[model samples]
Target: MAPTRTGSKRLLHDLNQSIVFNLIMEHQAISRIKLARKSGLPASTITKIVGNLLAAGLVLEVSADESSGGRRPVLLSINASAGYVVGVRLREATITLTICDLQCNSTYTRECSYQPGTAPQQVITIMATAIRDLVAEAGLTMQQIFGVGIGLSGLIDSARGLCRVSTILGWQNVELGPALERQLKIPVRVDNDVNTLSIAEHLFGQGREADNFLLVTIGRGIGMGIVLGGAIYRGSFGGAGEFGHMTVDVRPDAPLCNCGKRGCLEALASDYGIVRTALGTDPGHAIEDAIVNLIARAHAGESEIVAIFRQAGITMGIAIANLINIFEPSHILIAGEGLRAGDLFLEPMRQTIPRHTFDARDDIELLICPTSDDLWARGAASLILHEIFQSPIYEDEEALALDDLVSQASKAQKHHKK
Candidate 1:
């Protein structure tokens, strides 16, 4: 369907606001003149936009800049305390909740675990409670929060807020977002965990300067998020970045993946794959203990353990090479909980990418960003923040009217108290 004239104008305004907000964040402190120049917007347009931003408390005016033979211009910077957002990251073993301010600084975090076979409602109740506790701990009400963003490992139908499939959590067609929204009475956005990481990278991490990048996360599962032309490339069904399911081998005896497939890259290189390999040498160790011992043995220079890590690296390298050859991203960031194995897995992975990559393509920067569950949670928070900036609240007359009414009420209350 074609966008209407009003819709087009609204979109333009949203884009302008986002562009201005990002500029202020990047430059730290910039004058209207510089913002207009950098953003290529007219001076009048910048002035109008800046006024809305200031009124919204998204940007603050700082000290005046040195003038070039004219009136000194005030600098503008992001208002880190303007509002807050909540991020929830759901994993197989645990669910993490975090509340972050406008600048994405985590002010509160809570974590709780759920055993396998636990009902989704049980997990949701725990998460909702944690969110409320975090908000109370921060001494803020729901009105102070912009929204909530959820990052989960699964085949997410983001538009519908459904987890179409999640092998890690054993979920199918789970209406996670709608269910949570009903409980929390707040706006919600849900996306694949790796996609959330991509949002974090684009806004705050290594991809801040690169328009094209791929983020590959390796941990309990393998996942990928692709950013192209400065936005997430969520294919037709929001499942475009399923890199883990790509076949790396077809050997009949290859270990099975959580998805029930055999010979997939994730089956060979993920944490599960590493521990499965370790079972041969550390015969009696449980899965959890086996992983701990696997890393220790590799660090201790055990040839057998070292070989297992090396093979994982080779499979990972193959995956990396394919991404580069297919996407040609300017940057490829490999991150997640599993990288704690240090260089035991990386050195071999690094050594294998060059062998398969096309000439010159192999030179693309590969960044191994060390991340934790908290970072992923922040990534989820970033998704909500990103949307808030793009929302039409700044341009919509009804929203502006509501804000004005709220402000008047607060003032009246304060005057009555005095």
Candidate 2:
């Protein structure tokens, strides 16, 4: 009973601190008074939380600037150099590793490949080795790594850090988070790759302002990440973002999807499907001139090549129109490697979306951003960063551990300096 009470007290304190911390992060150079006002916490509570953050070396006090008051207030900002984080993205055979600072600026990246059907344990071992090598290459100790965040395709149970199923990886119920944690000796978080990208966008991209939006990624897969009411909406069983699996084409002769389902949107609009069709290649055969070449042909006005992209764009547009009608999101962000086709691929989607949507509003904005492996890897890193700065009300045991890592990292930095 005593221990339980103590734990509860600690949690409340941590929650309060998190509230204050987030206020400081968002405001960047906010005064204690401004923090109190923004966080709705009492002035004394704000003072205590700020003091703790300063003492922890997680935040810094900047000199006061001009203010229309008797005494100007000092500003607070996060210590970007307080620690480091590792972000990893796992494709079917290739793994990308990224090391970023607390601010999520990627400083180092590594690419590694494995046999396509590598066992889960073998894949985890590959990740552990690459991370260790990259950390050493970056001239940082393991202690400096706050944690590792991993993003992979398919049905990821983020809360449990389990890969419920990844058609791309040929895995099922793999305890990826725990398996990586054992080797890395730090906290680990796993999420759907698209969801991770959405997290990064929410924190730093177009999603900073838009609360209700959908992130539709198209590449090896066509998936969507949903954000509603300023929160990521992972539906029951944590499979909410499987937008690519939607039955867009129901015909028996429609292309087969990797999910063992026929006529999935992924089958018709995904990179493999479109490229396979354009090149007249059998499934699983690498086309001589791949998607890039096909895109070039489309750009050159090759009628047949252009037709394939137009059809794919129409299919994707219809799917998005369905998304718009159902969710009525204020913004739709389209990203992923498929954008390489340029207007040849997207112009049709842009043109087709409005036609299918019911009462589509002029105010809804569509955002398209370039994608890269580095960006995706950074998105993975933001998974750890998200937990660190996440609102305490929504936090669970993981938040407590993340906070502990922050304190530990700060102390490690100070010890190294000493």
Q: Which structure among the candidates has the greatest lDDT?
A: 2
lDDT of 1: 0.80
- Give the clashing residue pairs of candidate 1, or none: none
Off by over 4 Å in 1: 1-15, 40-43, 280-289, 390-418
Write down the lDDT that model 2 would get. 0.85
Over the stretch 200-302, how does candidate 2's per-residue lDDT look in tens digits? Answer: 9998888988889999999878888999887788888889979999897788888888788889998888787798676555445243248777888788889
The deviation in Å at residue 33 for candidate 1 is 2.5
- In model 1, where is the ten-residue run with the lowest total lDDT? 397-406
Off by over 4 Å in 2: 1-8, 69-71, 283-289, 401-403
What TM-score should be assigned to candidate 2?
A: 0.93
| Model 1: per-residue Cα lDDT over 41-134, one tens digit each | 9998899888877766668999998888878999999887767789989987788889998788988888878786688888887888888888
* CA error at residue 76 for candidate 2, angstroms: 1.0
Q: Against the hidden reference, what TM-scores do the models get? A: 0.88, 0.93
